[model samples]
Target: MVGERKQEKDVKREKVRGAQDKGRKTERKGQKSKRTECADFTDKPRIFPAEVIAGKPVDISCTFDTTCNGTAPVLTWDTPTDVSGSISNTVTQHGVTLTYTSVLTLTASLKHHGQTLTCRVRYPSVSSERTLILTVQYAPQDLSMTSLDMINASLINIIEGNSTVIICSVKSFPASNLTWRHLNVPMNRTSSNNELWLVIPHVTSRDTGDYECVAENEHGAVEGSITITVEHAPRNLSMTSLDMINASWINIIEGNSTVIICSVESFPVSNLTWRHLNVTMNRTRSNNELWLVIPHVTSRDTGDYECVAENEHGAVEGSITITVELIICCVESFPASNLTWRHLNVSMNRTCSSNELWLVIPHVTSRDTGDYVCVAENEHGAVEGSITIIVEHTPQNLSMTSIDMINASWINIIEGNPTVIICSVKSFPVSNLMWQHLNVPMNRTSSNNELWLVIPHVTSRDTGDYECVAENEHGAVEGSITITVEHAPRNLSMTFLDMINSSSVNIIEGNSAVIICSVASFPASNLTWRHLNVTMNRTSSNNELWLVIPHVTSSDTGDYECAAENDHGAVEWSITITVECRDSSEWTAGLLTAGIMLNLFVAGILTFVYVRKSKTATEERVAEISDIELSPSPLTVKHQGKQNMLLTDPRNTTREGETSAPQGSL
Candidate 1:
């Protein structure tokens, strides 16, 4: 029973706690549903419009709505986001669709680029956001600029003018406008002949300045500038004379600005300057004309003055002079004179002296007439003059009054014979005339009044002037006569009388010889000969002369001659002969000497042999004596008284057998 009561109490308490927990769980479920169902458009995908409404600012936005609850919801739209233009956007409530109205504004600025319109919508249970592009549809980055330069203009200076052109070009995408300005001031620009141009006719100093070209486009803008200068021709050139009192002057002159007034019918104008004497004057162009003002005047400046002009076509020059002095006085007509003519030997009155001024000429001839001047002078620079004096003349009359052929002229009896010429003439006084047969000189014949000439063998060497001079108290005169020589035939001869047979030789060595050549000539001739490459000596001799040879040799026999030459011609005669020597044994003199020597030797040997043999034979023989005995008895003495008997006088002739002879004592 106790267990039953505990279970019942626990049941009642648990029922009450379960009811409270169920209520709390239901409230938590409701709070979680509300939180999850709230609408947030940022979390969902939205579509933006392709093309924006042109010319206006339309802003795109996102808004939230929690009332709608379906797949496609109805919506409401409001104003745009961009403030540049009026907002005109419309939204339809068929699920979700939005469209913008157009307020077109074509005059848009660069800031309108990429502008867009916004369309915000409200739905019953859902929300959404979208944007539509609002583009001005303009050209971008359209502006550009370029430039060119002008250089090296030599023709501009030579042409004496100024011309120019601009080369800066401008390009833009939207066709920008270009304009030119000078020093920041707008310049006149025009379109003529389908091209933009800036023409400045008659350029002046004021035109030289900086220039600018401004280009503008819808996308951007650009500007550029250049410097320009204008030039003009030379001017104000003039010239003047330094010494006008001395008659010197020029029209135009200047140094710098003065233009050399030159005609420019062609392209280039000539340079201008001044010239005087042998030097050129330095000057420059100033205003209009070339100006030349010399500081001083001198004699050196008194030469030809010239103006020179030149161009590319050609050049020319003109000249004049500056005379420094003027003539003061001149005169004419003075003294009268008589004229006459005469013949002098050398020159026709080379000089006239005061003594020769007497005008008394002798033996009138035609050589002395010429124009003579006579001047007279006095105080004021003295002026007195006369005309020419004329002298008329004729040949003097002369003849041979007496002629002596033996004394002056003759004919030759033989060749080269001399002669004399003698002739006399009668004029105011007796005059002698000389003569010459031919051209050869004639020795002077006489002096003073009478002339004489002697000639010897007149030949071609004597063809010249033969003069006869006559003199007296009044004056002197000369008569000239030329003598031409006649051609005289000349003759000359050379003779070789005995040239060959005079040669001599020796038949033995070491002998003397001679060879003689006789050459004689009428007009004198020369003789020369050679032997063994040596010239043989020649001595002038008569016909029977001799040539001596000191020694002779075998080589002496060769071509030998004596060449004789004269005025006619020359001739050589020669002789060649060889000499043979005989043997020594064949000579009589050598044989006689040998024979005499042999005879003498043989006679000496024979005599010596005979004497020696005789001696030897005698040595070989023995001596023998005869034997006879005599017995002596007494000595017989015969005294002086014995004239008697002593036998028949022994002084007489003895008989064959004698009786007794005297005995001697033994």
Candidate 2:
């Protein structure tokens, strides 16, 4: 037993040794794997995007390959100044390998642009680091304006007609776009990187306002403004002569005091002055007003005058001219001179001299007409006045004239139209005129020896002889004209076979019918006949139209019309021709027979219905009586202690005080 036990121990010891060797081999493989595991950055820093927008959050991740060694990995990030960021790490396992992702979150700023961000990963056995260059995209900032020639100020003032340039600038990453604006409206400008130029070749009041410099980028926009003021000299200058009667021209009478005023419109107050004949005149100034006064004007003062208004910027001038008139004397004449007048080498008749030389003419007559001269000699000069007289006579001949009426003695006019009659007379002097119609005075208008008689809306009552009479103190004459009023045909009448009062005519079939249309009018009108609005055979005589229908038939049964037309209008008279049928008697007889038959049929039906109803009622009464039982006691009853009787037959019932039929007999 001792030998068997020792052998068992040796066998167990050998098995133990084999187990230990296997355990050692497994541990060695694991150690070798742990030693070979290394963390390496898989994503290169150059792969990251180069640009990022300021104030926007960005996420960047660095990936690494490593092995799991029972310890957590550490991730660290180094960020640029003014850039805030957070780092996180994620580990993913594939078999025995681990992928480490380190994510860095950052809010970028302009200060962070062109800076480096580093991400480092530390593992139990290995470590990795990555560096990335960041380019931060930012909007424009620090917008400002600089004046090229003028003073640099938020509010600037410039002289009118002067050139100026303004530069707009901004500071930004990625180069900002710049523009210029005037009073919130965009201005045309020349632009470059981060700057815009606004060039004004000539500055005027229109350019005075707030000017803005606007800078913009994909991120945002900013603006700054400056005020501009423009100063200008006086403009639209005007000069006025206060003593002149006309505003367009200066004309002052001799010995009259005159004043010239200067006016101007300008941004700044201006000084005003007056000059005459290119020489400065003595003037007075009050505020913007300057006046030059001449106490007594003369011919020497009749010259060009200029008013000048000037300011620091520039000056403007306005000019005017003055004129003077000399007075002259007048000559008079009486008893109407027989001589012609002469003034300034011109011969004047009495009428012309009366106006030109202020010469008086009294009792002017042709026999006293001649050249008359009145001479006045003075030391300075000699002047003469002469005149010739003429006389006017009264009317002599009178005549009538008209355009529409060929003959002045007579005229024909349509109703509701105007008529003009002119009575002309040959006379030197104008005459009083009047119109006489039907021996009664009428109102008329007179001009120069002519009498005008105008009649508007002429009617039948206005037709008469019109006499025009023209008279002056010396003579009188008269003329006459006749006016006739024409109107449309009226009071149209239709006659049948000389029956004048008839309006409509009826003719028998196969007989001739003559229809006459007569109308009342001053002048005979053209007449025609129409059947159903179509022209038919007609004969016209005077104001009458005759429509004759020969052998009238049923086909001719329709309305016929007679029409009459004159210069004024037209009139129509209508009549109905109802042709009598040839079979009238037969038609009447047939109608009577039909009516009789229809009445008889209706009567027979009514009689049969009445008889049937009577029979039915009789049978019903009999049946009802049969249903009643008869009493043997005479069918009697007592009422109010008097004998009252009941009849077996209902028709036999008795009224009060009436005898009843015997019951047995009923």
For lDDT, the strongest prediction is: 2
C-alpha TM-scores of all predictions: 0.22, 0.39
The digit string of per-residue lDDT tens for model 2 on 483-592 reads 76777788887765424235555555555555656776666678888887789855443565556564567899877778888776888877777766656677566456
- Compose the digit string of candidate 1's lDDT tens values, residues 29-127: 656433233354432223222223334343433322232233333333332333443333333332222222323222334454455433444445555
Give the poorly placed runs of model 2, Cα more than 4 Å off.
1-51, 55-57, 62-65, 76-89, 94-97, 102-134, 151-164, 179-192, 197-216, 219-249, 252-269, 274-306, 313-319, 324-567, 571-666
Clashes of 1: 54
Off by over 4 Å in 1: 1-149, 152-166, 171-174, 179-273, 283-293, 299-666
